[model samples]
Target: MGKHIKTIARPALQSTIKGCGCGECQTSCQSACKTSITVSNQVCLKESKQHR
Candidate 1:
């Protein structure tokens, strides 16, 4: 008998964002990635530090 393996979806940044857009999602510096999964420290820090 063959065993079946269930497939799991990759955790995307959108899922980690908690809320969609709504301003709240953008608050976290870690969630700054356009795609959101890969957190861009340079951009997030630069944006928040320089812009804010």
Candidate 2:
């Protein structure tokens, strides 16, 4: 007969969600660019998670 195996618990994972710093920009165009960049990055991360 085979010996029984035990499972071990893993530590909780931590992550930081950072923005593209659109709010810190002086011009409206710059702010809009930041916002778009941030949103695109976020969406990419989400998709990557699903694939993994």
Candidate 3:
């Protein structure tokens, strides 16, 4: 017997460059995210007041 595999849906690709600077993967993530984060070079970062 063959086993059934489950598939997971991942977030969509970045919609605009602006969203990228604001830390969003795509429109769907931006709309779903409750907290604000920044994304650069395809990395998600938190905006901090102090440079750390």
**Model 1 local distance difference test score:** 0.45
Model 3 clash pairs?
23-38, 23-39
Put down candidate 3 lDDT per residue, 3-52, tens digits, no spaces: 68555755555543453465343433333355434333333443332345
Model 1 misplacement above 4 A:
1-5, 10-19, 30-52
Task: List the candidates' TM-scores in order.
Answer: 0.19, 0.19, 0.20
1-52 in candidate 1: lDDT tens per residue? 2268555655555653653334422443444455454434324443355577
lDDT of 2 by residue, 29-50 (tens): 3355455434333334443555
lDDT values of the candidates?
Answer: 0.45, 0.42, 0.42
Ranking by TM-score: 3, 2, 1
Which regions of candidate 2 deviate over 4 angstroms? 1-43
CA displacement after TM-score superposition, residue 30 of candidate 2 (Å): 7.6
